[model samples]
Target: MSSVTSSSVSLPQGFIPVMLTPFLESGEVDYDGLKALTDLYLEAGAAGLFANCLSSEMYELSAEERLKVTKTVVAHTAGRVPVVATGTFGGPVVEQAQFVKRIYDTGVQAVIVITGLLAEEDDSDEIFIRRTKELISLTEDIPLGFYECPVPYKRLISSEVLAELLPSNRIIYHKDTCLDIEEVVRRIQVAEGYRFGLYDAYMVNAVASLNAGAAGLSCIQGNIYPELIVWICENYNNVERQEEVKLLQKFFVDSMDIVHSAYPIIAKYCLQKRGFPISTYTRREVGELTGNLQERADQLLEDVDRIQTELGIASVFRKTLEVPLK
Candidate 1:
């Protein structure tokens, strides 16, 4: 490992927004659409922005496209808040290292390293861990966060090994998304102190994670509804927000149940419907949002409006947040 030291942690503690990539008609990237989405999230009270990850459909874009997207987002964000880009998978250690180095020069606040590209059953922890260590060494200058996702592409970092890697401040923030609640609780028991901050990646498990000592969330829903996310993080510990949190949780379940079925496809489609500009229908292979998926999205859109009114958030903005579905 290189003896490079990490810089002081400056990333916002909670409510990091995972941005959705807006595409063009011919499947080209919509840089203008990206700027509009960035402005929307910033205005919606996002503490930070996460780009080119799952939410941004990083895997679908070409290397050059990824760089351009990251550069455009950083420029659009205009330093209003922190921007964390994903530099986890690009094949071989050298390529991953080069990818990390390229974005590091773009001035992102940090990078979130995915364990491996393969689903959990396909890859061993040894390969993932070794790559993580290598990537960490290469990215010694810019701080990195470990993304702990679930099975079928899972890279759930064990608390024990995570502790071992903890000494290197290169790994500062972690997005806790292990589907196993018991595992998350157990890990939280091990991770303590202000130096290591954890953010919830799942909406349903977020409350428990918050109670279990997660600093806050880096939410996918924040891509569509940011004010609600801001309220939860700021009021996560407050007794008054408990009821509101429950309502938000219900909204999350209702929304995610629909959106996640098609994933980035449905996500981008919803954003486009809401008058939030997007260049394309969806990312590659993920396909366009339609059929039963379209119906489900419509139902959820209506529900979100009702829930927003119930939570007294509709009046928060002049133009109501719309996810107009057909």
Candidate 2:
């Protein structure tokens, strides 16, 4: 196998925040906010950062905006840590590959792809088989991570089909948001020797996934409580570690209560509360999150601060999740 193929599936320990795109009153990308947020996460010990993604509202941004975000993030990060950007917009395969090429040229370390983006909702195994091959062909040589997000709007690739498509070492890892833990384990086990990994996006399943052989995690909860993630990764199965992980998990669930299911809205709100220059405003065309979600989100942050202080850890601590920050 090639070095990229044989390389360990494990990423550096801790949270890999899927960054939020701070916006202005006119709904333009807030460059200053983006820079400040990046600095804050790096200081708070995020394992890595992913830009132009679901959290960053890549689906709403134009291709030009996507490229701009990638450029700004890479430039600000310098060489401090690994950075990945979303590829495969809700567009044609070839057009998506063009977007991939554009960002790869910007020097991002990896590309995270959504398998298919079609008007009709269906995913034949052949789509992944052929599309991944085409992506590999077009990118020349950029590492790829499949974002196995739930596609309620479209067809989903089965775990069996995903396992079968692992021959392409370009698909090195997966950010699995599938709520089915058993299914994820079965799929990764099937692809054992192919250098694939699973990053648990659901905070509740994170410890279980790690115990089940996930190489790392890319959690949203990490945006607020990264130290717990780092501690779990560094000391899995230790007795003290169990207490810490349990506390962290409870903290995460409690935090979720404030937002309920308005995840993006709540996440951005918390980021702003942490002194990151993010606006609570989202594109109105995308629709608003119902309920007084932001109020609950604020309460969650207040609770987190109370917990962090009770534990005597700094409200936020720093660790290097990537190397050679520029």
Candidate 3:
């Protein structure tokens, strides 16, 4: 087991990509493909990696596969950047706590619990608080985080819950998808005295979030254009580049439909075009990429290429042929 203490560990504060799991045409986890994917994210200068996330098709993966995949990412990263994995979804609090312990054993910096898993749809704040507190108590010493996974149902936390939990210093990371700038600002204010980091997944409001003291971004857009995402985070505060950043943000908003309509399939296709050793096969029922979708992806790539050329960023796509991981 790793001797590093979880509480002392601080997650990197930049573009942490919610990675997609690679699958072979035969519908098996492609280890080599996964290694290459990890390398690609690192090469794009990702601050950290979020594995076994919704983008990774975690619901379809068996418990063993989730553990194996998380371990593989930790092994490949080799301490270059911290890795956080989704450790629990729907289960009894004890079972979920046990799962968190198992994931912690894999050497991840933090384990994320999907917010919807903590209580039933009609449960009150008191129930949610009790369950969360119990899970934290059960998984002592392991750093815990929360993801508002929109699947099943999106249970966004209330400010009252944040006020209750932040003081305990147990929840160190939160992937906020609320998309309300005012609410994000309010939460940041409420969390001022705590050590927790808030990462906004809503790209449309990412710059504003960072401006309002969000620690960083965790988004699927990073899966296709990690370098560009990193560039935004690195330059969002530059006075001279404020206009340019706003324009870039506008571009992202305008192009969201083209890139996100097909989701992981389109994301995989982007990777395939970028020379990763993976297929566009997804466990989700999203059908094959039709010609129209392919054309849209191509157009998006063209826009990306133009932006890269203008910004002097060497394209991450098809630029390197070797899959560095053996």
- The 0-to-1 C-alpha lDDT of every candidate, in the order given, reads 0.71, 0.68, 0.85
Residue 301 error for model 1, in Å?
1.6
Global lDDT of model 2: 0.68
Q: What is the TM-score of each candidate against the true structure?
A: 0.87, 0.84, 0.95
Worst 10 residues of 3 by lDDT: 317-326
Best by TM-score: 3
Put down candidate 3 lDDT per residue, 1-326, tens digits, no spaces: 55655557667778889989998878888877788789888888889899999999999899999999999999999999989999986779999999998998998989998999999888998999999999988988788888989987898886678888776577778999998999999888888867678899989998999999988999889888888899888888999888778878987888878777778999988777766657877899866789999988888888888887777787666756735322
Off by over 4 Å in 1: 1-5, 117-127, 149-152, 314-326
Model 2 lDDT at residue 140: 65
| Root-mean-square deviation of every model | 3.7, 5.2, 2.1
- lDDT for model 3, on a 0 to 1 scale? 0.85
**Clash number for each model:** 4, 7, 0
Order of candidates by TM-score, top first? 3, 1, 2
Q: Highest lDDT: give the candidate number.
A: 3
lDDT of 2 by residue, 220-256 (tens): 6665555556655555566755776677667766565
lDDT preference between candidates 1 and 2, better one:
1
Model 2 CA deviation exceeding 4 Å by range: 1-10, 118-120, 150-156, 224-232, 284-291, 317-326
